[model samples]
Target: MPATAPDLDSRAAAVLGGGATHAARTYRPAIRVARARGSRKWLVDGRELVDYTMGHGALLLGHAPPEVVAAVRAQVEKGTHYGAASVVEVEWAERIVAAVDSVEQVRFTASGTEAAMLALRLARAATGRDRIAKFDGHFHGWYDAVSVELDGAGRPVPGAGVPASMAALTRVVRADDGDALATALSDQQVAAVVVEPSGAHYGRSPLQPGFMAEVRRRCDETGTLLVVDEVVTGFRVARGGMQELLGVRPDLSLFGKVMAGGLPGGAVGGRREVMELLSPADGHVVHPGTYNANPLTAAAGIATLDLIVDGEARAQADAYAERLEREWRCVLSDAGVAGRVWRLASIIHCALDDPDAQARLPGALRERGVDLLHTSGFCSTAHDERDLADTVAALAAAVRAAARVRR
Candidate 1:
């Protein structure tokens, strides 16, 4: 019997779909986490694991940090949300504006996906252009227009439920080469180019600094708006998000993840003149969300940002991630596993050189005593050398287990 999360999780799986609301939480052979504190999680069956997932990159300060939890508890006791304006909402806006580079004005949304949809709409209204350019494999969100990709026929197909016309307006290109972007933007009707400054898939396929700079140059020359999607990398990357790390400013930016500190939230920010397109002065764009800045989420966001800036948490996360990546690589290598590790700040992804390796990896990692972070791992201040060491050992053992299996 698995010695981890047996009590609460058995009940959770019986009632909850796959035992968790989020699909990522449900893994083969089961990994049941009962509760978390600081950077550690306690299983219902009494096993403990270092919490590297860190709320899917949302907990910059680590799991249930005392400062953040206290802020949340204080707010919860008062009330979870007011359904009306509050000082906390105002504080959230001010903190976001101060932290991000391209943002001079900002608006909140329920999730990062909503922010991406809003940014695309505002770009069309502002420029009066219909077409948009986005890189291949960069996830903007679950939104309609951004969800499209080229089908087997080499024709772009709308993601199910998205208006087909919206898909038609999107131009897809590879993220590897910046020069290809110049050719696409030659269109006068192109309203904007939306990019994830981290390259793609939360930096799984990263872009070189020069490639991003080149894209910026082309957008400026063509008079096309540049929208940088920072939902995963926003506050998690640095105080200013990827904009500060890349040193390139976008016309518009989408932020989420760590900003909410485990609560649901999103924000769209950029220059005042450009963001003004969403208001009465232009009468071209309007963005309204009933739960945009719910007091609960704002309270959480303010506390998260305050910790990020004051404690220099981003640097600390990066330092820890570097060591974690190196240790895992060595372990997997010594085990004669063909897998390799990739990282951006604290986000680490391990993929095998073998095309089929990933499908089996998530299962094998769980067999060893530690809960695998699906295909990737996150590093936080709450994790120590032992946690890092254990994860590396898990990777090594998991790889060996897979090696013994025949296709």
Candidate 2:
């Protein structure tokens, strides 16, 4: 191992922008992971961290799960990519269709960003409309069409390089504002209203209980297609995703993260008529990618889905998350930290009531050998009691550290 992360960080910065490929992984005192398995990862310097990033909410079974690894290993011998349709892709699609209630047909993409883009395209083709509506703070992806930030008045402010005209086409509304949502959809100009069903940024700011149902009702009333971006929640929250838990069906569903079983893959699954727009028979839409359904990703996805479809993995993860949430709250109380912990399925969000403490919490936890995504933590089936105990202890220490800084 190198003496410090600087050598690796320099090499990364030389090749990759900001010394990281992903914005989230660009943490200070940069950590370079060498390998990961189960609930932990080792840095290049051999420091072990009980991981809560969990592949950015992709690895519900944890890193390098044996079953998924075996599937990928076996498929490598046969072929990596065929650049054409394969049996594995067909089987993978079938699994998704069977599991997701709204998905009658499925089209694979390289990432969740691509899936969101395709969902919007399909909605437009099917509805003959050009505009789309999305919730503020509900991130779909980095694509220019959806990479919009809301202003004080809730109007969209386009990200750099995104044309103002394009941003204008996307109507932005607060997730919980039923009146605003109804008004936006009532115009009949929106092709689809997209949302992260698990609320903004995967439950960082939780949505009200009936918000989803309200969105669905408004979409139906206005004939606007409902597009649920389940890229993070699908298969992780339940076999059918947030839809399964909420009993609300969408016209189109965006799936990634857990859907690909830790591999880089995504899909747009939904009504047959809308999805058929991609079929070349009518030539209405053209969707193509070099790695649309690479055999390796397909094999891994198939194995992962098989385990999760039974709901065993999800149940275990949710239980662990509940325990962590309860224990975290208790730890905060015992430490006299002004904070609260909440959960949505296997995902947990922690907030120090104080803004300064909240800002410092994640870094403090990192210093104590625990890694979280911002102030939130994701629980995986592979995370055991020891991991939970360690996390609680680390969180308590971090809270105390933040309190010290506040003092």
Candidate with best lDDT: 2
Per residue, candidate 2 scores C-alpha lDDT tens digits across 1-407 of 35567788888879997778888878777888888999998988778898999999999999999999999999999999886779999999999999998999999999999999999998998999999999899999898778887989756799899999898889888889999998888879999999999899998887899899999999999999999999999999888999988999999999999989999999999999899898787648888789898898899999999988889999999999999999998988888887778899999998888999888888888888898999888899999989998988898788889877343
> What would the TM-scores of all predictions be?
0.90, 0.97
Give candidate 2 misplaced runs (Cα > 4 Å): 1-3, 405-407
Write out the backbone clash pairs for model 1. Answer: 5-44, 5-45
Query: Residue by residue across 104-179, what tens digits does model 1's lDDT show?
Result: 9988899999999888888888788988988888888888779877666646667778897778889887785666
Number of clashes found in candidate 1: 2
For TM-score, the strongest prediction is: 2
lDDT per model, in order? 0.80, 0.90
Q: Give the root-mean-square deviation of each candidate in angstroms.
A: 3.2, 1.5
> Which runs in model 1 stand beyond 4 Å of their true positions?
1-20, 23-27, 44-47, 151-154, 281-284, 405-407
Q: With candidate 2 superimposed using the best TM-score fit, by how many Å does residue 341's alpha carbon deviate from the native?
A: 0.5
| 10 residues in a row with least lDDT, candidate 2 | 1-10
